[model samples]
Target: MPVYHSGFHSYVETEALNGALPKEQNSPQHPNLGLFAEQVNNSAFTAPRSENFKAWQYRIRPSVLHCSEPELITQHLIRDIHHKDSVLTPPTQMRWNAREITEEKVDVISSLVTMVYNSVAAVHLYAANSSMDKSYFYSADGDWLYVLEEGALRFKTEMGIIEASVGEIVVIPRGIRYQIELLEDVARGYICESQQAFYLPERGPIGANGLAEERHFLAPDASFENKEGDFSLYAKFQGQLWKMKIPYSPLDVVAWHGNLYPYKYNLKLFSPVNAVLKDHSDPSIFTVLSAPSLSKGTANIDFVIFPPRWVVAEGTFRPPYYHRNIMSEFMGLIQGQYDAKEEGFLKGCSSLHNPMSAHGPDMDVYTKASNEELKPVRYKDTLAFMFESKEPWQVTNFALNSVLRQKDYLTCWQSLETSFKEVVVEK
Candidate 1:
């Protein structure tokens, strides 16, 4: 197991070698141990002090040495929000079964399939069997949020290494070189690439605690590997794949001190907040992270999770209520069953509800919650998450034509019949 330091966006100063970091000042004329000093800025220099993100890395070789003549590569499955192959359809509910793992050797990069996207974010699904070998990848477009559903994965990043399994999530900052290695025979998951950076949601009246505590988010300690061989570095830039040959491993940072690095959080550790007395609170209470837009409360993208929690609301329908909203939602199950649907929605399944497209508990779930006793029930063994955006999502051509799509998804609510009856009272 790899060691990790806890705290979200907290400044971390770690070194694999003693005296590897400079004593004072960020960049010295000569860094300690003869290491090269480089600074990576995630935000503008004029950004607010509280929002500024940057890191100082002391490495064996400067990153400029990794540059080479790039060659264009063809990757039809991976797409951006502006891809011409995407399709826009009328507002409708959609659902899809989990993608099957490939039988042939495939890595995380080759298995990525874009499902839906907008100007704010792109949602993708991946199923792969082989680990990345002598190759690394980075994205110049957006930060990656990985929601692991099936197997374990080891991410070797420029900062350090992080191992994550099902019921966990990992976020890699944009422009960070990393390689994904399968810890199991097969791996399946969902990824949300957001143009904006992710930040913890405000707590408001919930006080200073509850809902994804900052101390639970873990970042890896400093580690490095010095090896020379024929290797390739792939980059996702301008909606296309580019490759360059390199002679050595990119994970050569001996020391780093900064707030901009990859991190991981376990879903089971999320402290969920919900209604305890009479009604269901808005789903915003479940949000783990949000990328804010120019508009005050609206987010470019919100990552929310529905984990195991207690249900104690009285005189109210326990499952989610039927309604419509301005934000679009793309949801996936990481494990077990979601409470909103008694059937059909299974582990690893995905569903989408565009803006103003009404979605709620299915017929069976509604009937059961309405008639069953309202005792204090504890939901267990379930994990589901959603990637919500203010902008509506457009389905990709490949997702629309996939056989796993549920064509009869609308029929799940067709059986809902009117139960209203008028009564007269004597005046």
Candidate 2:
């Protein structure tokens, strides 16, 4: 659902002024409006099956204004390629309780705790008490996928503004400078970083009607802040954070036109395609966004969600079936209880099941779904999601040692007593 279409050749533009946008063409020289034109390229110019994303910007000033020696700053963020040390041997299941930001004040970068990362992708959790003032950030390595679970975040980006609240998502393409402003006093959420550009997954037989309609996908209108003062530009390059002093704010794009822009979508807007008859459909049906891998038909990262929807399948098991998967799954609960996890999987709870790891319903959920009468049951007050990736997720030291980590997560399945009974047939 997230990968709308190939990003190349599609020009999605939002103009804030009449006649402000250059008409009929891009890369105009010596503009009559006296605005500097710049281009941003997100992909290689000559890649096969190229979804090359390029955006033209008209701003009050060019981005070349800031060039200084960057200072390597330290933070809670951790990045690694193979992540061998983070993966626990025998592959244990892990969980974290809801983390409320009631401690010392922290900003976006300061609050980030990267749970897992490779050369291809990284998973992070954040809870911030303050906004970014006179600061901006850009990641040269990958695009960012943000899923806010607790509070709203106002993102002031180079292209425009995109605000994501609880049950919503925003994707900032790699190299787009943006700063966050917490609408609430505190904000908590998950972040997924991909080394490749993310696109709406191919709908295949589902066609264009369901799952993250491109028409519903909206980009911000051109807006810029003309501020001149001491500023800090933070960049994440080669898996390190660097800070540089600048004299002006980076959020200064007055007008822009291109498919290479940030966009926002509410998770509730997704038209879930479920099994009408007897079995649970593949969770791929719930994918909101996907980053495809080099291998065909497989994803580097699939952003899937379990939103509130109807469950009406006669003479069949309703909950998710127990199984092991090749792709590692990292799941988080944004709101109510997950259908498959009856207890202990509270709001803000996070879990990880590595490749080929067995995971399924808790004892209570299995019992209830098996015996309950079949009816059109509406699963309300719930929004759960997963970052299902092709590669196994390696847990960070922070994730393993955090106070929020649950020590007894493995006990949720301990109550599944052996029910294997041999039935003798009477002739």
Candidate 3:
């Protein structure tokens, strides 16, 4: 069956087969096919906002059947910024080359490296060599946004199956049971888990035609697994991983219908709105998804992109201007190069500039853009993105001490000569 494209707030009803869903009512006194009705609420029942998301499902077995005594596991995924061995360093631009798999047979959950955490969200770097078998993981902490930098990952969730590759992102709502199986030998990517719901930013004057169209966002159709085996349901709650043993597979949703289901979007489909006359537009114009914080105008986490686009502005600085931002920026390149940095920023590589951190174009890019002809130039073969947050990220010890980190990252702008002019522009 073809996948449906419904707006985030609109109702989307789907079933594995016809008549599986109850007619005229969401929760029926007797569900069809001897199924049990379950509601997955992503927001409070009486939330005033119309964007409040929730879904209902008629499954083969109630989720209560999968419940058991949970035992604490030794997976310490939370990065303590104030810890004695924390990698919290002075504010400076940091970059790392694509990391290598140091160990063999690393699974997705185990490969997670919690880079930073704050009240709103947490940033994580993940690289896995093997697929998780008979193991499913979900977080009671927050919803997850997965940006695949390398490798293909197929996620089998209670709702359905969704596959994500490089240059694509898959969002798994909080508390949704899902397990990832890698299609490639090794998978590397970035993940952001936040307490807030990621939504499309208001188009305002730009209207709703440009940027990421909600119709292009693909949600999986009704699909399920009826496997009977020794399975485990792993939950990450309160910054710790807990495992609950179950006899049968917990992914037995025979039929489901909901707007809160997981979905994936391709970055290439983003219609970028760029400058036509003067200076470069703010990166917020390229934001695919944004999680708004309590503070108005500031985002908890804005998933913005630097997609391949044309540079056509005349008599203006073509590259990003040097400035300090109030938001913390965590950038990762999915493929090709970032315009601000001519080198070192490669696919699967990442860079970070904390809140109010001084950062801009590299010396080489700055010099080239200053002298290069100002014409309509199309920047091709590049897809770089950032998880910009309102709060600063507490760097993890592993990221601080990783061999992939560039030791000479601070020297990128050393060649920028001081061009201070003694005579100011006279009126």
- CA-lDDT, candidates in order: 0.91, 0.82, 0.84
State the lDDT at 421 in candidate 3: 78
Top-scoring candidate (TM-score) = 1
Q: Which residue pairs clash within candidate 2?
A: 2-200, 2-288, 3-199, 3-200, 3-201, 4-200
lDDT of 3 by residue, 1-427 (tens): 3354545545677787788888778889999988889999899888765667888888888788765799988755555322224345668888888777756787888888776677688888888999999999998878899999889999988888888788889999989999899998889999999888889888999985899887888887777777877899988887777899888777878777767888888899999998998887888999999999889999999999999998799989988899899899999998888899988788888888997889998889998989988989999988899999998876777678778788899898888997887987889
Please tell me which predicted candidate would have the highest lDDT against the true structure: 1
In candidate 2, position 12 carries an lDDT of: 66
Tens-place lDDT digits, model 1, residues 153-220? 99999999999999999999989999999999999999999988899999999999999889999999
Residue-pair clash count for candidate 2: 6
- Tens digits of per-residue lDDT, candidate 2, 365-384, equal 88898899998999999999
Candidate 1 has its poorest 10 consecutive residues by lDDT at 81-90
TM-score of each: 0.97, 0.93, 0.94
Clashes of each: 0, 6, 0
How are the candidates ranked when ordered by lDDT, highest leading?
Answer: 1, 3, 2
Those runs of model 1 whose alpha carbons end farther than 4 Å from true positions after fitting are 422-427
